[model samples]
Target: MNQLSTNWVLGHKVTPYQTTGNYNLVKGESPAGAQGPPPHIHKKYEEVFFILQGQMEFVLDGRQSTVTAGELVNIPSGCLHTFSNTSDESCLWLNIHSPKGFQSFFDAFGVPESEKDAMQQSLAAERITDVLKRAREFDMEIKIP
Candidate 1:
């Protein structure tokens, strides 16, 4: 069994997280209408997402696809991608990125769910700005669209 963290990032609970040479894995739950990061490309990492519950809308490259439970999305290195929980209920999923490193990006922004006003702090203007500014350092090239 994997250990889950109590931290939340961008309103999602992500855990069973770990960084390794081959890949990194994280399980997450996204609330209805919640979105992931801005469209971005990882210069070297390849990512895959397996939806476990509800569904999410993903924008890969410039095309949109709705991925549902029991479905998976494959993203290659340098592909511009982003996703959102567009369904009426929350979505659960597992994500893996090969050649691990991006977990630090979440570490820099994730907040403990038990903290008072955790959500507010996680989405503060300054923090969002900081995320945008430092994202490239994490190999994520944000695409404004």
Candidate 2:
């Protein structure tokens, strides 16, 4: 069995799979009260989220929906979407990006879990310029509205 490597990105503990599958699989745990990435759109891939435990509030295209364990949601390519753990407990979920490749974004911007403290310091020290630059490289556009 292959051990999945975990990274801490924007308060989420993400474990990405390394299989040569059609889609990239990332399991993420979001702490209570944590907000996910800002509403963003992926031009090249569709994203799906499956709630494994706890609950999540997903805002898709300006509509808000609360999903609980055993539920799932899909955001098509080019759709604006974001999610957060609004419940009192942490939320465990699986994120899938079709046609693969999106994991590169996490790899480039995320910090390994072991170095979370350093990552937080670096994030605070660095400006958004680096993140925006990297997002462009991954075909993701962060929407301000």
Candidate 3:
């Protein structure tokens, strides 16, 4: 398990790669009131989110819905989607992306929990900007709103 800290509220546990170019799974946790990434669309991959703990509010293609533990949400390619922890407790969820490769985005922008010095180095290297600049290379498009 590779632990990733994307920010104060978002944490990710990346499962080891088992098959190349097939799929990627990431276990994610967010504190209450935490907001996810800005609405975004993937041109090449389909994404699925499974709620494992608290509730989350998902906005998909301008529609908002609440998903609780044991529920799942699927966002197809080219759909705009984002999610947030709406309950007053931390929410645990799984993010699965088909056709793999989305893990590369997390690897590039997320800070490894055990590597504090690496985090600092990444920060100094302007990782977020780099992520935005390189997003298309991973078949992702981030929308600003």
Task: Quantify all predictions' global Cα lDDT against the true fold.
Answer: 0.85, 0.83, 0.73
User: Which rank order by lDDT, best down to worst?
Assistant: 1, 2, 3
Off by over 4 Å in 2: 116-129
Candidate 1, RMSD to the unseen true structure: 1.6
In candidate 3, the residue pairs with backbone N, CA or C atoms under 3 Å apart (3 or more residues apart, or in different chains) clash, namely: none
lDDT tens readout by residue for model 2, 20-110: 7788899989888877777889999998999999999999999999999999999999899989898889999999999888988878777
Stretches of candidate 3 exceeding 4 Å from the true structure: 1-21, 115-127
For model 3, residues 36-113, the per-residue Cα lDDT tens digits are: 666889989999999999899999999999999999999999999888876789888888899878777776666655
TM-score of each: 0.92, 0.90, 0.78
lDDT of 3 at 89: 94
* Best model number under TM-score: 1
> lDDT score, residue 103, model 2?
86
State in Å the error of residue 136, model 2.
Answer: 1.7
Instruction: List clash counts for every candidate, in order.
Output: 0, 0, 0
Which order, best to worst by TM-score?
A: 1, 2, 3
